[model samples]
Target: MTVLDIDGIDTYYGNSHVLHDVSLTLAEGEVVALLGRNGAGKTTTMRSIMGVTPPRRGEITYRGEDIVGKAPNEINERGINLVPEDRRVFPTLTVHENIVLAHKLAADPRPVEEMYELFPVLDGLRRSNAQNLSGGEQQMLAVARALVQRPSLLLLDEPTEGLAPVIVDDLRTMLQDVVEQDVTVLLSEQNVTFAFDLATRGYVIDTGSIVFEGSIEEIREREDLLEQYLAVSPEEVA
Candidate 1:
Protein backbone atom coordinates (compact mmCIF):
# COMPACT_ATOMS: atom_id res chain seq x y z
CA MET A 1 0.00 0.00 0.00
CA THR A 2 1.17 3.53 -0.67
CA VAL A 3 1.74 5.36 2.58
CA LEU A 4 3.05 8.52 0.94
CA ASP A 5 2.43 9.76 -2.58
CA ILE A 6 4.06 12.80 -4.19
CA ASP A 7 2.65 13.44 -7.62
CA GLY A 8 3.95 15.99 -10.11
CA ILE A 9 5.30 18.34 -7.41
CA ASP A 10 6.59 21.73 -8.45
CA THR A 11 8.25 23.73 -5.69
CA TYR A 12 9.91 27.13 -5.77
CA TYR A 13 12.25 29.13 -3.59
CA GLY A 14 11.20 32.73 -4.17
CA ASN A 15 11.11 32.98 -7.99
CA SER A 16 13.57 30.12 -8.48
CA HIS A 17 12.01 26.79 -9.23
CA VAL A 18 13.69 24.01 -7.25
CA LEU A 19 11.52 20.93 -7.81
CA HIS A 20 10.20 20.38 -11.32
CA ASP A 21 7.48 17.84 -11.88
CA VAL A 22 9.03 15.51 -9.31
CA SER A 23 7.13 12.44 -8.23
CA LEU A 24 7.74 9.43 -5.95
CA THR A 25 5.95 6.96 -3.73
CA LEU A 26 6.63 5.15 -0.49
CA ALA A 27 4.93 1.93 0.48
CA GLU A 28 4.15 0.98 4.05
CA GLY A 29 7.29 -0.38 5.78
CA GLU A 30 9.46 0.29 2.73
CA VAL A 31 12.60 2.42 2.58
CA VAL A 32 13.21 4.65 -0.44
CA ALA A 33 16.35 6.63 -1.12
CA LEU A 34 16.62 9.99 -2.87
CA LEU A 35 20.11 10.34 -4.37
CA GLY A 36 21.69 13.49 -5.81
CA ARG A 37 24.44 16.07 -5.54
CA ASN A 38 24.23 19.40 -3.73
CA GLY A 39 21.61 21.84 -5.15
CA ALA A 40 19.87 18.93 -6.84
CA GLY A 41 16.65 19.73 -4.94
CA LYS A 42 16.81 16.61 -2.74
CA THR A 43 16.33 18.68 0.41
CA THR A 44 13.63 20.73 -1.30
CA THR A 45 11.70 17.58 -2.07
CA MET A 46 11.91 16.51 1.58
CA ARG A 47 10.88 19.96 2.82
CA SER A 48 7.94 19.96 0.43
CA ILE A 49 6.69 16.69 1.87
CA MET A 50 6.92 18.14 5.41
CA GLY A 51 5.06 21.27 4.22
CA VAL A 52 8.00 23.43 5.20
CA THR A 53 8.19 24.36 1.52
CA PRO A 54 4.75 23.66 0.15
CA PRO A 55 4.63 22.76 -3.49
CA ARG A 56 3.05 25.49 -5.57
CA ARG A 57 1.49 22.80 -7.73
CA GLY A 58 1.19 19.15 -6.75
CA GLU A 59 -0.62 16.58 -4.71
CA ILE A 60 1.00 15.25 -1.55
CA THR A 61 -1.13 12.50 -0.14
CA TYR A 62 -0.44 10.64 3.07
CA ARG A 63 -2.48 7.54 3.88
CA GLY A 64 -5.01 8.55 1.20
CA GLU A 65 -5.48 12.03 2.68
CA ASP A 66 -4.38 15.19 0.90
CA ILE A 67 -1.74 17.10 2.91
CA VAL A 68 -0.73 19.78 0.46
CA GLY A 69 -0.78 23.35 1.81
CA LYS A 70 -0.98 22.12 5.39
CA ALA A 71 1.32 23.67 7.99
CA PRO A 72 4.49 21.81 8.97
CA ASN A 73 3.18 20.92 12.39
CA GLU A 74 -0.10 19.73 10.94
CA ILE A 75 1.67 17.45 8.52
CA ASN A 76 3.96 16.25 11.31
CA GLU A 77 1.01 15.50 13.53
CA ARG A 78 -0.27 13.29 10.76
CA GLY A 79 2.68 10.91 11.30
CA ILE A 80 5.47 12.44 9.21
CA ASN A 81 8.68 13.50 10.97
CA LEU A 82 11.82 14.98 9.45
CA VAL A 83 15.46 14.77 10.54
CA PRO A 84 16.70 17.84 8.72
CA GLU A 85 20.01 18.04 6.85
CA ASP A 86 22.01 20.03 9.42
CA ARG A 87 21.20 18.01 12.57
CA ARG A 88 19.28 21.01 14.02
CA VAL A 89 19.48 20.20 17.73
CA PHE A 90 19.06 23.08 20.17
CA PRO A 91 22.57 23.99 21.32
CA THR A 92 21.61 25.45 24.68
CA LEU A 93 19.55 22.43 25.63
CA THR A 94 20.98 19.43 27.39
CA VAL A 95 20.88 16.11 25.52
CA HIS A 96 18.13 14.98 27.86
CA GLU A 97 16.37 18.28 27.40
CA ASN A 98 16.45 17.96 23.64
CA ILE A 99 14.76 14.57 23.78
CA VAL A 100 12.21 15.90 26.27
CA LEU A 101 11.39 18.85 24.04
CA ALA A 102 10.79 16.48 21.16
CA HIS A 103 8.59 14.34 23.36
CA LYS A 104 6.35 17.37 23.94
CA LEU A 105 5.44 17.28 20.24
CA ALA A 106 5.47 13.51 19.90
CA ALA A 107 2.51 11.21 19.92
CA ASP A 108 3.06 8.10 22.05
CA PRO A 109 6.60 9.28 22.55
CA ARG A 110 9.42 6.86 23.29
CA PRO A 111 10.82 6.99 26.78
CA VAL A 112 14.27 8.44 27.43
CA GLU A 113 15.31 4.97 28.54
CA GLU A 114 14.25 3.48 25.20
CA MET A 115 16.14 6.21 23.35
CA TYR A 116 19.20 5.37 25.41
CA GLU A 117 18.91 1.74 24.37
CA LEU A 118 18.82 2.79 20.73
CA PHE A 119 21.76 5.12 21.28
CA PRO A 120 23.83 4.16 24.31
CA VAL A 121 26.12 7.18 23.96
CA LEU A 122 23.09 9.36 24.50
CA ASP A 123 22.68 7.63 27.84
CA GLY A 124 26.28 8.40 28.73
CA LEU A 125 25.93 12.11 28.01
CA ARG A 126 22.31 12.62 28.98
CA ARG A 127 23.12 15.67 31.08
CA SER A 128 25.55 17.31 28.63
CA ASN A 129 24.46 20.23 26.42
CA ALA A 130 23.78 19.41 22.77
CA GLN A 131 26.33 21.94 21.47
CA ASN A 132 29.10 20.11 23.29
CA LEU A 133 28.35 16.72 21.73
CA SER A 134 30.40 15.32 18.86
CA GLY A 135 29.09 15.20 15.31
CA GLY A 136 28.05 11.55 15.62
CA GLU A 137 26.30 12.13 18.93
CA GLN A 138 24.39 15.09 17.52
CA GLN A 139 23.29 13.04 14.54
CA MET A 140 22.16 10.24 16.83
CA LEU A 141 20.30 12.79 18.97
CA ALA A 142 18.59 14.14 15.88
CA VAL A 143 17.39 10.70 14.85
CA ALA A 144 16.44 9.78 18.40
CA ARG A 145 14.43 12.97 18.80
CA ALA A 146 12.47 12.28 15.62
CA LEU A 147 11.91 8.65 16.56
CA VAL A 148 10.46 9.84 19.83
CA GLN A 149 7.54 11.15 17.79
CA ARG A 150 6.61 7.55 16.89
CA PRO A 151 6.01 8.69 13.34
CA SER A 152 4.76 6.26 10.73
CA LEU A 153 6.69 7.96 7.97
CA LEU A 154 10.19 9.34 8.65
CA LEU A 155 11.94 11.74 6.31
CA LEU A 156 15.69 11.73 6.90
CA ASP A 157 17.61 14.38 5.00
CA GLU A 158 21.34 13.65 4.62
CA PRO A 159 21.57 11.92 7.96
CA THR A 160 25.26 11.15 7.60
CA GLU A 161 26.45 14.26 5.83
CA GLY A 162 29.67 14.99 7.73
CA LEU A 163 30.14 12.08 10.10
CA ALA A 164 33.08 9.72 10.22
CA PRO A 165 32.83 6.33 8.51
CA VAL A 166 32.35 4.52 11.83
CA ILE A 167 29.52 6.82 12.85
CA VAL A 168 27.86 6.45 9.47
CA ASP A 169 27.92 2.69 9.86
CA ASP A 170 26.35 2.99 13.28
CA LEU A 171 23.59 5.16 11.78
CA ARG A 172 23.03 2.54 9.09
CA THR A 173 22.42 -0.05 11.79
CA MET A 174 20.07 2.32 13.62
CA LEU A 175 18.06 2.89 10.44
CA GLN A 176 17.91 -0.83 9.87
CA ASP A 177 16.39 -1.19 13.31
CA VAL A 178 13.84 1.53 12.60
CA VAL A 179 12.59 -0.10 9.41
CA GLU A 180 12.29 -3.40 11.26
CA GLN A 181 9.62 -1.70 13.37
CA ASP A 182 7.64 -1.14 10.11
CA VAL A 183 8.15 2.64 9.76
CA THR A 184 8.37 3.88 6.19
CA VAL A 185 11.55 5.84 5.44
CA LEU A 186 12.26 8.30 2.68
CA LEU A 187 15.92 9.20 3.01
CA SER A 188 17.75 11.89 1.04
CA GLU A 189 21.42 11.03 0.78
CA GLN A 190 24.51 11.85 -1.30
CA ASN A 191 26.54 8.99 0.07
CA VAL A 192 25.82 6.23 -2.42
CA THR A 193 27.25 3.48 -0.24
CA PHE A 194 25.05 4.42 2.68
CA ALA A 195 22.01 4.95 0.46
CA PHE A 196 22.36 1.73 -1.50
CA ASP A 197 23.15 -0.26 1.59
CA LEU A 198 20.16 0.99 3.53
CA ALA A 199 17.61 1.25 0.73
CA THR A 200 16.42 -1.39 -1.71
CA ARG A 201 15.18 1.19 -4.22
CA GLY A 202 16.53 4.63 -5.14
CA TYR A 203 15.41 7.66 -7.13
CA VAL A 204 18.21 9.68 -8.68
CA ILE A 205 17.60 13.42 -8.91
CA ASP A 206 19.52 15.81 -11.13
CA THR A 207 19.01 19.52 -11.68
CA GLY A 208 15.45 19.33 -10.32
CA SER A 209 14.06 16.11 -11.74
CA ILE A 210 14.12 12.38 -11.05
CA VAL A 211 16.28 10.90 -13.79
CA PHE A 212 16.32 7.31 -12.59
CA GLU A 213 14.34 5.05 -10.30
CA GLY A 214 15.24 1.41 -9.79
CA SER A 215 16.55 -1.28 -7.48
CA ILE A 216 20.05 -1.16 -6.03
CA GLU A 217 21.22 -3.78 -8.48
CA GLU A 218 19.85 -1.86 -11.42
CA ILE A 219 21.56 1.32 -10.26
CA ARG A 220 24.80 -0.58 -9.75
CA GLU A 221 24.66 -1.77 -13.32
CA ARG A 222 24.31 1.76 -14.63
CA GLU A 223 27.75 3.22 -14.03
CA ASP A 224 27.37 5.70 -16.87
CA LEU A 225 24.28 7.24 -15.35
CA LEU A 226 25.79 7.27 -11.89
CA GLU A 227 28.93 9.08 -13.05
CA GLN A 228 26.98 11.58 -15.12
CA TYR A 229 24.77 12.63 -12.24
CA LEU A 230 26.69 11.95 -9.01
CA ALA A 231 30.28 12.61 -10.31
CA VAL A 232 31.92 9.96 -8.11
CA SER A 233 32.09 6.23 -8.72
CA PRO A 234 30.45 4.12 -6.03
CA GLU A 235 33.17 1.55 -6.53
CA GLU A 236 35.71 3.99 -5.10
CA VAL A 237 33.79 4.06 -1.84
CA ALA A 238 33.04 0.35 -1.94
Candidate 2:
Protein backbone atom coordinates (compact mmCIF):
# COMPACT_ATOMS: atom_id res chain seq x y z
CA MET A 1 0.00 0.00 0.00
CA THR A 2 1.29 3.49 -0.77
CA VAL A 3 1.44 5.62 2.33
CA LEU A 4 2.60 8.71 0.48
CA ASP A 5 2.57 9.65 -3.21
CA ILE A 6 4.25 12.88 -4.22
CA ASP A 7 3.59 13.23 -7.94
CA GLY A 8 5.19 15.99 -9.95
CA ILE A 9 5.37 18.54 -7.13
CA ASP A 10 6.77 21.92 -8.07
CA THR A 11 7.76 23.84 -4.95
CA TYR A 12 9.11 27.38 -4.76
CA TYR A 13 10.53 29.94 -2.35
CA GLY A 14 9.43 33.53 -2.97
CA ASN A 15 9.92 33.44 -6.73
CA SER A 16 12.91 31.07 -6.46
CA HIS A 17 11.92 27.80 -8.10
CA VAL A 18 13.45 25.17 -5.83
CA LEU A 19 11.82 21.88 -6.78
CA HIS A 20 10.90 21.08 -10.38
CA ASP A 21 8.49 18.24 -10.97
CA VAL A 22 10.01 16.26 -8.10
CA SER A 23 8.27 13.01 -7.28
CA LEU A 24 8.59 10.01 -4.96
CA THR A 25 6.48 7.53 -3.04
CA LEU A 26 6.66 5.59 0.25
CA ALA A 27 4.99 2.28 0.82
CA GLU A 28 3.55 0.99 4.06
CA GLY A 29 6.19 -0.35 6.49
CA GLU A 30 9.06 0.70 4.27
CA VAL A 31 11.97 3.03 4.96
CA VAL A 32 12.96 4.98 1.85
CA ALA A 33 15.81 7.46 1.59
CA LEU A 34 15.81 10.69 -0.38
CA LEU A 35 19.53 10.93 -1.06
CA GLY A 36 21.02 14.27 -2.01
CA ARG A 37 23.81 16.75 -1.44
CA ASN A 38 23.22 20.21 0.01
CA GLY A 39 21.01 22.46 -2.14
CA ALA A 40 19.48 19.45 -3.84
CA GLY A 41 15.96 20.30 -2.52
CA LYS A 42 15.69 17.39 -0.08
CA THR A 43 14.60 19.68 2.75
CA THR A 44 12.24 21.55 0.46
CA THR A 45 10.58 18.32 -0.54
CA MET A 46 10.00 17.43 3.10
CA ARG A 47 8.66 20.88 3.87
CA SER A 48 6.26 20.64 0.96
CA ILE A 49 4.86 17.36 2.25
CA MET A 50 4.19 18.81 5.68
CA GLY A 51 2.45 21.80 4.07
CA VAL A 52 5.03 24.26 5.40
CA THR A 53 5.64 25.07 1.75
CA PRO A 54 2.66 24.13 -0.37
CA PRO A 55 3.53 22.96 -3.84
CA ARG A 56 2.62 25.15 -6.78
CA ARG A 57 1.74 22.16 -8.95
CA GLY A 58 0.96 18.42 -8.80
CA GLU A 59 -0.49 16.24 -6.09
CA ILE A 60 0.65 15.16 -2.63
CA THR A 61 -1.60 12.36 -1.57
CA TYR A 62 -1.27 10.89 1.89
CA ARG A 63 -2.99 7.56 2.13
CA GLY A 64 -4.90 8.48 -1.06
CA GLU A 65 -6.21 11.76 0.26
CA ASP A 66 -5.14 15.02 -1.36
CA ILE A 67 -3.21 17.09 1.19
CA VAL A 68 -1.59 19.65 -1.05
CA GLY A 69 -3.25 22.75 0.40
CA LYS A 70 -3.94 21.46 3.88
CA ALA A 71 -2.52 23.33 6.85
CA PRO A 72 0.56 21.87 8.53
CA ASN A 73 -1.27 20.85 11.68
CA GLU A 74 -4.10 19.43 9.61
CA ILE A 75 -1.66 17.33 7.62
CA ASN A 76 0.02 16.20 10.83
CA GLU A 77 -3.29 15.26 12.34
CA ARG A 78 -3.82 13.02 9.37
CA GLY A 79 -0.93 10.85 10.64
CA ILE A 80 2.24 12.37 9.20
CA ASN A 81 4.98 13.67 11.48
CA LEU A 82 8.25 15.42 10.70
CA VAL A 83 11.51 15.33 12.66
CA PRO A 84 13.52 18.23 11.39
CA GLU A 85 17.33 18.31 11.18
CA ASP A 86 17.73 21.16 13.65
CA ARG A 87 16.64 18.92 16.58
CA ARG A 88 14.62 21.62 18.31
CA VAL A 89 13.60 20.88 21.88
CA PHE A 90 12.18 22.98 24.66
CA PRO A 91 15.37 24.65 25.91
CA THR A 92 14.37 24.90 29.54
CA LEU A 93 12.01 21.96 29.85
CA THR A 94 13.06 18.81 31.65
CA VAL A 95 13.32 15.66 29.55
CA HIS A 96 10.17 14.30 31.13
CA GLU A 97 8.40 17.59 30.62
CA ASN A 98 9.21 17.61 26.94
CA ILE A 99 7.78 14.15 26.54
CA VAL A 100 4.67 15.11 28.48
CA LEU A 101 4.20 18.23 26.36
CA ALA A 102 4.23 16.20 23.19
CA HIS A 103 1.17 14.30 24.35
CA LYS A 104 -0.87 17.44 23.86
CA LEU A 105 0.29 17.71 20.28
CA ALA A 106 -0.18 14.05 19.46
CA ALA A 107 -3.39 12.84 17.92
CA ASP A 108 -2.84 9.45 19.51
CA PRO A 109 0.09 9.67 21.88
CA ARG A 110 1.84 6.51 22.95
CA PRO A 111 2.32 5.68 26.61
CA VAL A 112 5.27 7.39 28.31
CA GLU A 113 6.82 4.04 29.21
CA GLU A 114 6.98 3.04 25.53
CA MET A 115 9.06 6.12 24.75
CA TYR A 116 11.40 5.34 27.66
CA GLU A 117 11.83 1.73 26.59
CA LEU A 118 12.80 2.71 23.04
CA PHE A 119 15.32 5.25 24.35
CA PRO A 120 16.62 4.06 27.72
CA VAL A 121 19.17 6.87 27.95
CA LEU A 122 16.23 9.25 28.10
CA ASP A 123 14.84 7.41 31.12
CA GLY A 124 18.02 8.13 33.05
CA LEU A 125 18.02 11.79 32.03
CA ARG A 126 14.34 12.31 32.75
CA ARG A 127 15.09 15.18 35.10
CA SER A 128 17.76 16.99 33.08
CA ASN A 129 16.95 20.12 31.12
CA ALA A 130 16.82 19.51 27.34
CA GLN A 131 19.55 22.14 26.96
CA ASN A 132 21.91 20.04 29.04
CA LEU A 133 21.60 16.87 26.98
CA SER A 134 24.25 16.04 24.37
CA GLY A 135 23.62 16.55 20.66
CA GLY A 136 22.83 12.89 20.11
CA GLU A 137 20.54 12.77 23.12
CA GLN A 138 18.69 15.81 21.79
CA GLN A 139 18.25 14.09 18.46
CA MET A 140 16.78 11.06 20.22
CA LEU A 141 14.42 13.30 22.12
CA ALA A 142 13.29 14.95 18.90
CA VAL A 143 12.53 11.56 17.39
CA ALA A 144 10.79 10.35 20.52
CA ARG A 145 8.58 13.41 20.56
CA ALA A 146 7.55 12.75 16.99
CA LEU A 147 6.81 9.10 17.68
CA VAL A 148 4.43 10.08 20.43
CA GLN A 149 2.26 11.53 17.71
CA ARG A 150 1.48 7.97 16.66
CA PRO A 151 2.05 8.74 13.02
CA SER A 152 1.58 6.27 10.20
CA LEU A 153 4.18 8.08 8.10
CA LEU A 154 7.29 9.81 9.47
CA LEU A 155 9.43 12.32 7.61
CA LEU A 156 13.00 12.75 8.79
CA ASP A 157 15.30 15.35 7.30
CA GLU A 158 19.07 14.90 7.67
CA PRO A 159 18.62 13.00 10.92
CA THR A 160 22.30 12.13 11.44
CA GLU A 161 23.93 15.19 9.96
CA GLY A 162 26.17 15.98 12.93
CA LEU A 163 26.83 13.17 15.35
CA ALA A 164 29.58 10.99 16.67
CA PRO A 165 29.94 7.64 14.95
CA VAL A 166 28.83 5.77 18.08
CA ILE A 167 25.75 7.95 18.46
CA VAL A 168 24.86 7.40 14.84
CA ASP A 169 24.98 3.66 15.44
CA ASP A 170 22.61 3.99 18.37
CA LEU A 171 20.24 6.08 16.25
CA ARG A 172 20.27 3.45 13.53
CA THR A 173 19.24 0.88 16.12
CA MET A 174 16.45 3.09 17.42
CA LEU A 175 15.13 3.66 13.91
CA GLN A 176 15.29 -0.06 13.24
CA ASP A 177 13.00 -0.53 16.20
CA VAL A 178 10.68 2.11 14.81
CA VAL A 179 10.45 0.31 11.48
CA GLU A 180 9.75 -2.97 13.24
CA GLN A 181 6.77 -1.30 14.85
CA ASP A 182 5.41 -0.65 11.31
CA VAL A 183 5.91 3.08 10.99
CA THR A 184 6.67 3.99 7.38
CA VAL A 185 9.49 6.49 6.89
CA LEU A 186 10.70 8.88 4.21
CA LEU A 187 14.20 9.83 5.36
CA SER A 188 16.19 12.63 3.76
CA GLU A 189 19.89 12.02 4.24
CA GLN A 190 23.30 12.91 2.84
CA ASN A 191 25.22 10.16 4.66
CA VAL A 192 25.14 7.25 2.25
CA THR A 193 26.37 4.70 4.79
CA PHE A 194 23.80 5.73 7.35
CA ALA A 195 20.98 5.57 4.83
CA PHE A 196 22.19 2.21 3.54
CA ASP A 197 21.84 0.76 7.01
CA LEU A 198 18.25 1.98 7.38
CA ALA A 199 16.65 2.28 3.95
CA THR A 200 15.18 -0.49 1.82
CA ARG A 201 14.88 1.78 -1.27
CA GLY A 202 16.51 4.99 -2.45
CA TYR A 203 15.79 8.11 -4.50
CA VAL A 204 18.62 10.39 -5.58
CA ILE A 205 17.59 14.04 -5.86
CA ASP A 206 19.83 16.61 -7.52
CA THR A 207 19.39 20.34 -8.17
CA GLY A 208 15.66 20.09 -7.29
CA SER A 209 14.82 16.98 -9.29
CA ILE A 210 14.82 13.26 -8.73
CA VAL A 211 17.61 11.72 -10.81
CA PHE A 212 17.52 8.13 -9.63
CA GLU A 213 15.10 5.80 -7.87
CA GLY A 214 15.84 2.15 -7.16
CA SER A 215 16.56 -0.51 -4.55
CA ILE A 216 19.39 -0.16 -2.02
CA GLU A 217 21.46 -2.90 -3.69
CA GLU A 218 21.33 -1.03 -6.97
CA ILE A 219 22.81 2.06 -5.31
CA ARG A 220 25.51 -0.01 -3.58
CA GLU A 221 26.62 -1.52 -6.90
CA ARG A 222 26.62 1.78 -8.79
CA GLU A 223 29.67 3.73 -7.64
CA ASP A 224 29.73 5.79 -10.80
CA LEU A 225 26.18 6.95 -10.24
CA LEU A 226 26.85 7.91 -6.61
CA GLU A 227 30.00 9.85 -7.46
CA GLN A 228 28.34 11.64 -10.37
CA TYR A 229 25.27 12.77 -8.41
CA LEU A 230 26.17 12.66 -4.71
CA ALA A 231 29.93 13.18 -5.12
CA VAL A 232 30.40 10.11 -2.90
CA SER A 233 32.88 7.32 -3.39
CA PRO A 234 32.33 3.61 -2.75
CA GLU A 235 35.08 3.57 -0.11
CA GLU A 236 33.47 6.37 1.90
CA VAL A 237 30.14 4.56 2.00
CA ALA A 238 31.61 1.13 2.55
Q: How does each model score on lDDT?
A: 0.89, 0.91
Q: What's the TM-score of every candidate structure?
A: 0.96, 0.97
Task: Specify the poorest-scoring 10-residue window by lDDT in model 2.
Answer: 103-112
Residue by residue across 1-238, what tens digits does model 2's lDDT show? 9999999999999999999999898989999999989889999999999999999999999999999999999999999989999988998999989989987878678988799999998999999999999989999999998898788998999999899999999999988888787599999998888899989999999999998999998998899778988888888876
- Looking at model 2, the pairs that clash are none
Q: Write the per-residue lDDT of candidate 1 for residues 107-218, one digit (tens) a residue.
A: 6787767888888878989899999999989999998999888889999999999999999998888778777775899999998888888888989999999999998778
Report the poorest 10 consecutive residues by lDDT, candidate 1: 229-238
Please state every model's RMSD to the true fold in angstroms.
Answer: 1.2, 1.0
Question: What are the clash counts of all predictions, listed in order?
Answer: 0, 0
TM-score: which candidate is best?
2
